[model samples]
Target: MRLISSSISLATAAALLSACATLPQGTSRDSTNTGLDVRTRYVGLTSDAEVAEILASPLGEEAAVRLALFNDHTLRARYDQLAITEADLRATGLLPVSDGARTPEAGIALPVLDIFLIPLRNKQGITIPERIEIEVTDHAVALIADVRRAWTRLAVAKQAHNLAKMSENIARAAEKVAVELADKGNLPADELVARKIAVANAEHAVIMAESERREAREDLAGLLGVDLMGDWFVHNADPATIPADLNAVDMQAVMDNSLALASSKAEVARVGASHGITDISSILPDIDLAVSAERDDHQWEVGPSIEMPVPVFNFDGPKREKAEADVRAAQYEYAHSLVVTANRAALLVRERDAAHKLVKLLNEQVTVAADQAVAASLRQYNAMQTGVFGLLAIRENAVEARRHQLQGWQRYRNAEVAVDAARAGVILPLKN
Candidate 1:
């Protein structure tokens, strides 16, 4: 019977040990979509499909913006940082304390006296979470600023593409004119060659413009958490239509809303002071309950616990200094950012105003040049005294005027984008 019992106990022990030693299988540990790679979806999209979908599909813009929001690796990392800080805050709030031990001894020969003592454990208070919260808030604000910048870039790219298309149309017309003049033996071969070169350059410019537009779309898509390969397009919203009115903004009022700086300063102070003080709490039985136990000859005693850390080696001296320095650094950075933003806004506004003036001047010049070219051409052609050189010169002047007008228009658009960027407190709309 004893041998049978021993065998049963050994078998039970082995089963328990096996259960404890076994680990979960790969399938059990795997998460939803664990084997799939999200990035592959983007890589699978052909360049032509990307461009065609962006230009033709209604979902293009939405997908692009969403990709920027979610798939952009950089933004994803920032989100992860924010999550970590949130977890840290939760951990800080729960402040764990170690349990104390109790031991009992019989009162030997002395029947009238009973003695009991409990060892106390000391715990130092932690205040790093408050500082961490401040840092996280600052990071969040910076991330928002980054998003604004990326969006501005996206907007600028779209405008550039539009301008490039316009330029390409003009270049094609000029090329046709050059070919006709060359066939009539009225223009030199060199002039025809120049026009052909201009056409090629314009075509190249269009290709570059398309590339930039694609990059901007991808950037914005990443920021908005959309698939890069997804069909989407950004609506060509005229950012220039928005007017900048200084009266609409109260600088002082806006400055007052810097909560990150304020919180950081407060946190620094809170953390520094907390480092010098110890947090104390009790987990002892009630005195009345102890007295009740005393009547049963197993007397319980009320124990006082002292929790403290001996500041022999690490007194958090360096840590306090670092915290104070961080507060100052944050203040400085906040101030600097405000100043830089204001300066940039002012500069962009001035640039836009200048570009608008230039555009107006170019428009007037184009009108006057067009009238001159028409009058010159008609007089020379009707009088039958028109030289090839004179006719070609006038036509060339008209073409140059048109080119200048186109350039002015492009500049105006660019300036408008700049002004919008300034007002929006960002340089580009597409998130990098």
Candidate 2:
């Protein structure tokens, strides 16, 4: 007797789980607020004006990341996904009901198996929104890593282009002197030809450097959503001398925060929920109850009937096996993700430390030595103790040393960014 009255609750839950194949188009303001709130919780910046302020001047790595967050359409779409998932969660929690009237004999038909599984379904519905939110944050952190990498490349490209121009100038001057000496019969023709070849090679280096700079600039521009026609510049600041303290890091916290690990954990939980539901559903038969009224000879009779399927051929054996296997696979995946995330964090920290040490060595010892060598050679040339060619050779060596120093800085900065990303729960490739 109470089954007829309780059927509405089961019907509503079933509708909540399976209804709404088509949601309303476009994001709601509330969903946008939720996305923005999550972003602010992680990114710290709250307004577009903050990003605009950073973009108004020279682009720093931080500014580049901020600009990308504010301008990238792909990131906006990710935020929109957060909104969409939130809508689904809300809709599932508040099951929609129609106001249309029902006939006296009209009664909801609910699978008896589903009556036991609605709680698990509700739990999963709640978990999905939380998982999607984590994914959104993961995407945002990934974008920041990408922007930082592009900024580093553009900075290095500019430095290389300047070095190439300096080399070109040196080669042109050497060739001019060689031409004059050859005209005066003071230099061999072959040596003059060699100087010309050196000039041509320097020109080629300049061209290649310019091309690289252009490509780097375009890549950074695309990330920042900025026009290439603008006079934006990146500061070529030296990387930090000190390395991050790896010993103080909490490995468990790092793994917990990792995007890959979190996604895997969510999957395991979701599959476990379904596995539990299916485990119970397999032991129970599919049954339904119907209430109807019949009138005959000006008399009305009301009765309730119970209907159940006999398990002669299908006993849910395959379904239960599948559920158990799915749960085991999800658990294994989560375990694998945990191991990979821990290893990745350790490796990135080690690499960052190594990069810092290399940069410090280049700055303190090798670069200073190269500079001193150049100065000594210049002084020797002024005293006529060294020829112009010898001075130029020493200068080239100094430039090479500087190039190595700059490259070391690039590697160190990129490594630092990657370490930061790992700490922030996103893994990014270290720039070479």
Candidate 3:
């Protein structure tokens, strides 16, 4: 049996598919770099220099984003995925017969049987560009989000850990004074005990913060598709001072950029557009029309035939139902992404705003007051107006205030990352 569409040959389809193996538009080196930043791709630097450049200068948030876009293994995988989607699209356009690759239809019958068979009707599906558009957008957004999220996590953890080190140093200094006073019989038993406890607590906090920092770095490594064995320094930015104008957030634009909802919409479009031609064995299902030639006992006859199914009990009922169900499922997912993600982005913005306010309060009032109190206590202790234990106690309160400030900053950064992810499902123009 020889079955094929009459319009396109197998070689032509393979050539077309081969020509499209490169990365899709947005995910290409240029487009991806453009989305992350304004600078053009680094053409002059060798790979080592590029790594040195990222490590040499304190890698800021934007730079880290660029680094992820350029170097992350998963981002490369996404580009590979686009090629795969193109391959699938080309596969659909090839001859409908499964054996099109090994054996081409030439109207030749088997020599042993001396008979020829050919499909009367054959139809080919041409892929619409919109079928793969959503995937391209979604993958680009995912790359951007993952890179920033990991970078922010690592940066925030480093900030908290640095503060923890400061607190630990202060606590250790206080413990040294307490031990001296206790040995000289100048400190009370309870005061010495409290000083020791504070020292132990501060040490534990530093240990925990260090662990948190390492975990954050590991997360970044996972995003970059690398192991965390090498020394990597992340440049930290004070996010509390970074101006993110809430009023500037384009809610409508963000919604429009959403790749998730767009993907769902594309799904509905794909299913609907393909409904007419999906089933191959139906006359009404974009009937496969074919021409056949046969020789019957030295009589040559040429005829046109259609490989259509009679409208019996199963007249594309299951296929139509399946397509409808797919549309419904996609619609639900889009609705959830729209309503839930939009609200979620709004809530995160609110949290970031609230955290900013708290950071302001801690920076201006609570931390300032704690610093003054500690300074006053230090002076009093020098003049014998306050005991060493009293100074240590005030220092503990000061450390606690600073810890709160660190928390506020971390919360603000985390909220910023979340908002970026929320903004992803919406489509952004990929400037080529």
Best by lDDT: 2
Error of 3 at 289 (Å): 49
Q: What tens-digit string does per-residue lDDT give for candidate 1 at 185-225? A: 97899989987897798799889978987887776665655
Cα lDDT of model 2 overall? 0.61
Which residue pairs in model 3 clash with each other? 121-288, 122-288, 257-425, 257-426, 257-427, 258-425, 258-426, 258-427, 259-425
Two-way TM-score contest, 1 vs 3, winner: 3
TM-score of 3: 0.63
Q: Write the per-residue lDDT of candidate 2 for residues 206-297, one digit (tens) a residue.
A: 99999998999999998888778677788775544445443455555455456575566556556656555433222222222235777869
Task: Kindly give the number of clashing pairs for every candidate.
Answer: 34, 0, 9
TM-score of each: 0.44, 0.70, 0.63
Candidate 3: segments with Cα more than 4 A from true spot: 1-46, 81-132, 225-227, 237-240, 274-337, 426-432
- The residue-by-residue lDDT of candidate 3 on 1-432, one tens digit each, is 323212211111111112222322332233233231111132122365675656666666655555554565543554455445544544555323222221212211111011101110111122424434444434544555556666767877788788888777877888798889889998898978887897799889989999988998988876654447766677774644745444445555444444554554445445544654343222222111235677879997664332322222233578767755654554455445556556655676677677767777887789899999999999998999997668877987887887787667766666655555444443222110
Candidate 1 Cα errors over 4 Å, as ranges: 1-136, 244-247, 267-432
Mark the 10 consecutive residues where model 2 has the least summed lDDT.
Answer: 3-12
lDDT of 3 at 266: 48
